[model samples]
Target: MDLIADILLAAGALGAGIYCLVLGRRLNRFNDLEKGVGGAVAVLSAQVDDLTKTLSSAQNTAAGSAQTLTDLTQRAEEMSRKLEFQMASLHDIPDTPAREATATPAAPVSAQTTSEPMFVRHRAAEAHQ
Candidate 1:
């Protein structure tokens, strides 16, 4: 009976030792720097750093663009206000000249003296003559 117990214990120890050896090998592979989880983690870490830098640069560019857009919007608003003021001033002007108001009405030209259409400067002087 003692001999049988010793044999069973020895077999169990041998099996445990074999299991430990296989586990150690698998653990080594899992942590391998070139082809396992360790390599994947390293690659991911590098990508995160690159993305962080890119994101920061993009944020800065967006901020600059926003500031520029704000400035342009302000300038456009100022121009619109100036245009409105100019349009308001345009309403103050008279449609007819003051000289025309004081002048007497001219005689109508007959088609007998002129043939085709013509434009003459200083028509008031010619009308007096």
Candidate 2:
């Protein structure tokens, strides 16, 4: 009876040792997985920061471009107004040289001579007459 009891005690001790070994391996694997997760989180945080900076720069550049376009449009409109005024003033210039060139006095012509034939359709005479 003593010999059988000793054999059973030895078998129990061996089983406990194997269980502890397996538990230790599992703990090590869990620690390794935790370290991998931590590394991945650090890399992702850095990438997020880089993306944020790029977005801010793009926003500033877009705002500046919009302002420049607005200013250029205003300048173009002003130039168009000045050009219109200059064109209106140009209509009065044809008689200036004639006034300056003629100095001799002459008798007035008859109304018949003053009225000439119409080069195109006489819309000017028709509307006034």
Candidate 3:
């Protein structure tokens, strides 16, 4: 009976040793820096770093564009205000050049004749003679 117990204990020890060896090998493979979970993690870490830099650069570009847009908006508003003022001033003028040239019935005919161009004045003098 003692000999049988000793044989059983030896067999269990051998089996345990074999299982431990296989587990150790699998653990080594899982932690390998190349072609394993460790390698995948390293690749992911590098990608995250690259994405972080790209995001920062994009944010900077967007901020610059926003500032430019604000400046342009202010300039456009100023120009619109100036145009409105100019339009109002044009409205204040009493008469256009065309209306002034035609002359109203209220003015003396002689005033219209005197205001004529030099060529017209000479032509009138010749006609009178």
**What TM-score does each of the candidates earn?**
0.65, 0.48, 0.63
After superposition, the stretches of candidate 2 with alpha carbons farther than 4 Å from their true spots are: 1-37, 95-113, 117-129
Model 2 clashing residue pairs (backbone): none
Better candidate by TM-score, 1 or 3? 1
lDDT of 1 by residue, 27-93 (tens): 9999898999998999999999999999999999999999999999999999999999999998987
Q: By TM-score, highest first, what's the ranking?
A: 1, 3, 2
lDDT of 1: 0.90
Q: After superposition, how far is residue 91 of candidate 2 from its true place, in Å?
A: 2.4
Q: Please identify which of the two predictions, 1 or 3, would achieve the higher lDDT against the true structure.
A: 1
Global local distance difference test of model 2 = 0.80
Whole-model lDDT per candidate: 0.90, 0.80, 0.88
The most accurate candidate by lDDT is 1
Best by TM-score: 1
Model 3, 14-118: lDDT tens per residue?
999999999999988987889789888999999999999999999999999999999999999999999999999999765648666577444675875786574
lDDT of 1 at 99: 88
